[model samples]
Target: MKKEIPLAITFISGVLLVLALFIPHKPFGNLEEIFNDWYIIVSGFTFLLGIDSLLGYNFGKLKRKEKDAPYALVLILSFFITLTWGIVEIVRTPEHNPFGPTSTFSLYFYNSIFIPLQATMFAILSFFIASAAYRAFRAKEINSALLLVSAVLVMLGRIPLGQSAAPYVITVIFLIFAVYFFAESAGVTEPKIKIAYILVALIFVALIYPLGFVYFRQHIPEFADWIMNVPQMAGKRGIMIGIALGGIAMSIRIILGIERTYMK
Candidate 1:
């Protein structure tokens, strides 16, 4: 009964919502709004349940005298303090309640503390992201080499001195890779051939340094802009389309009762 009722409710809600979207007239016209209100009401109760779970878990840690009990206590106290402050603000100044744009809570708690803390968290996270990107950008193959080149271009393009310095940076990068490849050619059984390869690489870099510097110094930013506006944008749209299609598939499965993971 429990499973059947919920599944039936889900199917009905899904089908009705789909109908309401396509046929917005009379009975179906207000279904979306009605369902949204019901959802909000249900969400409020779920929020209470979340609070209960949070507090209960923390209190259990405190009771058990765990090593992380202090941190748990801090979290519990902070939650109550913030909640109490919000309630007090709402009662004391209903017009400029805690959640309002110009309220004390917005200024002091949200903007002052929360915003800075969030920024700091993201700043810390960027190091980890950079570390991951370093591994991903390693030029093990042709695709990765292109990715590395594009990433370097995009990064340099965004910086203030990137235009002026990009030429030198790119020249140095080419020189390094040339030297690396020249060194890797130690397996060349003949000294003449090995020296010839090194000479060719050096000459190539020398030529590239002059011509590429002149051209890229003027056009690197534009090239980066094109990469971002075209290639990056296309990739992003493709990903969003894939996500939308997947979401639709999942919704259909839920509607048809083919997916019963929620019941479990």
Candidate 2:
């Protein structure tokens, strides 16, 4: 009966909310706003539950005298300290709310401690990003090779001397790849295929210096901009559309009571 009642409530609320979105009439029109208010109230209680869970877990660790107990203790202390400070500020100086930008809490804690911590976190993430990029940009195949080239161009476009240096860099890369392919062609048993490969490599190396470096030197940034704005934007929009469709499908499943994972 308990499970059935909750499931019934979920189905009714979800269907009503869906109807409220499409049909903004007398009954359904107020459902959305009412649901939002209920959500806010429910969220406040959920936040208290979250705080209880966090503190309880940390306290358990401390009680066990674990190796990481000190770290947990610090976390517990920091939370209470910050919470007490905010409460004290609220009572002591009502005009200067703790949430205000110019308040003591914002200036001392948020700007001084939080911002630097955030920057440090991102700085650490950059090394991981660089490692991932290095792996991704390896010229394993034609697609990866294109990706490497596109990435290089986009990166160079963003920098000050990138436009001028891009041609030379790209020329050097072409030469290196051309030499590698030419070397590979020497081991090929098929005369026609070997000759074709060698000719293609030689032709590419030959054309890069004259046409690429001379004529297209000034247009590197523009070409990079085109790649970013056109191809990148199209891919991003497609991913976003897929995500929206998935969310809609999930919402429908929940509304129909087909999704019962949340009951657990």
Q: All candidates: CA RMSD in angstroms?
A: 3.5, 2.4
How close to the true structure is residue 19 of candidate 1, measured as C-alpha lDDT?
96
- Model 1 residue 123 CA deviation (Å) reads 2.9
lDDT of 1 at 119: 97
Clashing pairs counted in every model? 0, 0
The runs of at least 3 residues in candidate 1 whose Cα sits more than 4 Å from the true structure, single-residue gaps closed, are 83-107, 188-211
Q: Give lDDT tens digits, candidate 2, residues 97-146.
A: 78788677757888889999999998999899999999999999989998
Compute the lDDT for candidate 1: 0.87
lDDT of 1 by residue, 1-264 (tens): 978889999999999999999997978999999989998999998998999999999999999999999999999998989988888888888888687667877678788888999999989988999999999899898799789988998988888898898888888768766777687668787878888878867875886666458877888889889999999999999999999999999999999899999886
Off by over 4 Å in 2: 25-30, 94-96, 102-106
State the weakest 10-residue window (summed lDDT) of model 2.
209-218
